[model samples]
Target: MAPLTSASDENTHQTLLNTLDIYSAPKPFRNASWKPPQRRNKNTKAILADAARKESSQVTTANSGTSTPAADTAPPNIAQAAQRLDRLVLEKSLIAPGPAVTYTNIEAAPSLRPERTRHYCDVTGLVAPYTDPKTRLRYHNVEVFNLIRTMGSAATEGYLEARGAHTVLK
Candidate 1:
């Protein structure tokens, strides 16, 4: 039996050339006459300064407890409105507010955790039997363990971090 050669395969070469030709062909312009939107001639800094002036005037009038009809009707910024709502809620005892929910609090309890922790080798991505004490990197065999032992501190930390086992100090 003769071994099939790539150079002798005229059909495969022609197919590849045809594929390249199809890709290299000029694509049609979807929006040939399209133009970018025109920009405003206004100065951003001046606009910002004007807005700041208006905000400051409103704040001053509100703080003095002599807000005009226009100032009183204007909606408050999100942070200011949220603070006001919080204060109102606290004053009226609307809801029985408790401790803030966080990642640490929401995580599964120790009693609900799996009995056997699965360990995997960072290098091989296989079931690891041994863990290096210094680097805390799990290894499948002596060869992987030896590789981890010879790695620099940065490389060792990187391997541990990739597996989410790197120890962080305060």
Candidate 2:
């Protein structure tokens, strides 16, 4: 008879036991389900507000000897919140300048990165790799290039001037 030298035989049974969802408690441990709780996307602030309102309404009704269900109020949607933010900004501006080093939508924007300087097709506004030497208009493909060539010189100059690349000094 040969003694077992393999560790696999000992590990397999223990791993299987750990993986199983045992329904009954054996001795020391209490009966428990290890399954994860279900997930739900909920507005917790509105929930708490509803609960508070319910308690207050219940108290008032009990005192008056009348029973009434508390109406549940839903939280404001994104648009309403945005409008509120805009109003706050307007009010703040009217009152006084904000604290020092304050950053707003139009003010205190970060500078553009030189490494992220990407050209786009003037015609289609897509990522452009090819640049026409005549008008210096960025293009995505040969089709766009042909379109530029057919365009009048004034239009060609317009595209170049718009992008701050002047071919004809005008």
Candidate 3:
């Protein structure tokens, strides 16, 4: 039998090209089903601020308050525990200082549904580099998601503070 040659590969190449032309025309725009930012009620904000303040104060007092002479002798143990707790609070404080607040978002998997193609952003439809037959313009879902996630991560403090307050209520 003859070894497979690059010339023979042309047939597969042509077949892929034929298949690609069907998708070459950009997919129609689909309304991106992203959720909008939620509006916080003033009362809710006040309540949350109060709760977070209360919880942190309570935690500080309970963790720091002690009236035992033994506590002075075994100060290392208390100090170690206090140091760990302080470290944790400091870490959380960093997150709580972020500027932008986060709201939950639910995304549907992008799938080929011919009827729904016209509403979404065209950029979402582009195939990844390796998958495309040509090396031209390619759009990666991961890249887009990463960009968005980075923006969200930058707002970590606001997101955590709101989430923290909510968690305390629960």
TM-scores, one per candidate: 0.33, 0.34, 0.20
- Per-residue lDDT of model 3, residues 1-170, tens digit only: 43244555767767767776966776567657867779865764576567667766765566553322244455367787787667767755664453322122134234466573232212355444422122122236667545434544334334335434212333
Which one is best on lDDT?
1
TM-score order, best first, reads: 2, 1, 3
For the record, the alpha-carbon RMSD of candidate 2 to the native fold, in angstroms, is 16.7
Better of 2 and 3 by TM-score: 2
> Which predicted model would earn the best TM-score?
2
- Give the Å error, residue 117, model 3: 14
**Candidate 1 collision pairs:** none
Misplaced by over 4 Å in model 2 are 1-106, 109-115, 167-170
RMSD each, Å: 19.3, 16.7, 28.9
lDDT (CA) per prediction: 0.70, 0.67, 0.48
Error of 3 at 154 (Å): 39
Superposition TM-score, candidate 1 onto the true structure? 0.33
lDDT of candidate 1 over 22-141, digit per residue (tens): 668877865888788898665755665676577657556654442222455544688876776676556434332333233345442367555897888999999998888878889999
| Local lDDT at 113 for model 3 | 60
**Candidates ranked by lDDT:** 1, 2, 3
